[model samples]
Every structure is written in structure tokens, then in C-alpha cells.
Target: MTTNTPLIELTAWMRGRLAERVARLIDAGHDPHTGPDLIITPLGTTGEPGTRADRSCDRCGRFVSQGCILYMITVQAAPRVLCVGGLCGACRRLEDGWQA
Candidate 1:
């Protein structure tokens, strides 16, 4: 269980960062949601991770082709909310349902 502490921390940190960015964009009257469209497609229900050429996992910086599973991570820092995708399978496994 202790092994997952770092991953949980990293996930929280990433979410906080993303939330801040989204909040800033919203305050500036810009639509932050549309920005991810060019980088990711709508979340799929194929029960398997999708592939994206030339893209690296947002968490571990690994190539998606290297068995990385894409995920739509929800970021909520306050009134701002958004979802960011891209996390490797290894990292996801390490999480093991311990995500907050």
C-alpha cells in the first residue's frame, strides 16, 4: 500500500496543476476544453487503451505505443473543471483503485 503513495501524490499534483491552468483559461474568457481536442479523441468505450502516434503518457512520459493506456483524468480545483488524458498502463496499474 505504501508503494502507491508516490503515484497518488503525483496524480494529485498533476490534477492541481491542470485545474489551475483551466481556471486561468476560463478567467481569461478562453475555452480550455477545446484545446485537448487536437491531442485526444473523445473517451472510448472499447475496454482497451487507444493508440496515438508520437504521443507520450502524460504521467510517465512513455510512448503510447509502449502499452500505455489513455485515461481521461478529471481535474477540479474549484469552480473550474476539465479532463486531461494520457497515462501509461504501468502507472495506472500502480494506482490500483487507490485514486482519490
Candidate 2:
């Protein structure tokens, strides 16, 4: 028999992991209402190109410079604040193992 998890299951798993991560961020002083609201969108979706300067990877705390591929997460508190959290390329690739 073939061994392949369904796409739906993989998607759900990713979402759950992301939720847990966000919760951890909140617990680690990244609370949306009390701290900067991270507004993470796709790289191109932000109407800009390449990665943001001086933005570190929220997952591993690695310094990320421009031109590097990144996956960002957004933490928001409505009309209060907006900021961005990110994961460097290495972390992003590592996270891919979550599907397994």
C-alpha cells in the first residue's frame, strides 16, 4: 500500500501546530493586546519584494536580512497594534517535517 497522508490532514496538522506556536508566543511576552501586533503576510502580498530588514526569526531568534526567503506570522489585536514575526529559511524547511 502507498504511504501518504491526505492533504486535508496535513493542512489541519499545520494549522494546529501554528496555533500552538502562537499561543507560545503569547505566553512568551508576545501577547497581542499588550505587545506589538505582528502582522505577517506573504512576502509579495505586502506590496513589497524580498524579506524585511533586521527582522529576526521569531521561531529560532535568528537574525534575518533582506533577500532571504522567510515565512512570517501575524499577531494582531484589532485596532491596537500590528507587527510581524518570522521564521528563517532553515526553520521553515525544518518545519516541513511536521507532516511526517
Q: Model 2, range 28-71, lDDT digits (tens) per residue? A: 66553444434332221232344443366655667667666657
Which candidate comes out best when scored by TM-score?
1
Q: Going through the candidates in order, what is the number of backbone clashes in each?
A: 0, 5
For candidate 1, write residues 1-100 as lDDT tens digits. Answer: 0111223444564655565566666787766444433222221122244444335555566666544345535433333233445556665654344433
What lDDT score belongs to each candidate, Candidate 1 first? 0.46, 0.47
Can you tell me which runs of candidate 2 are displaced by over 4 Å? 1-54, 74-84, 98-100
Model 2: which residue pairs collide?
37-83, 38-75, 38-83, 39-83, 40-74
Specify the poorest-scoring 10-residue window by lDDT in model 1. Answer: 38-47
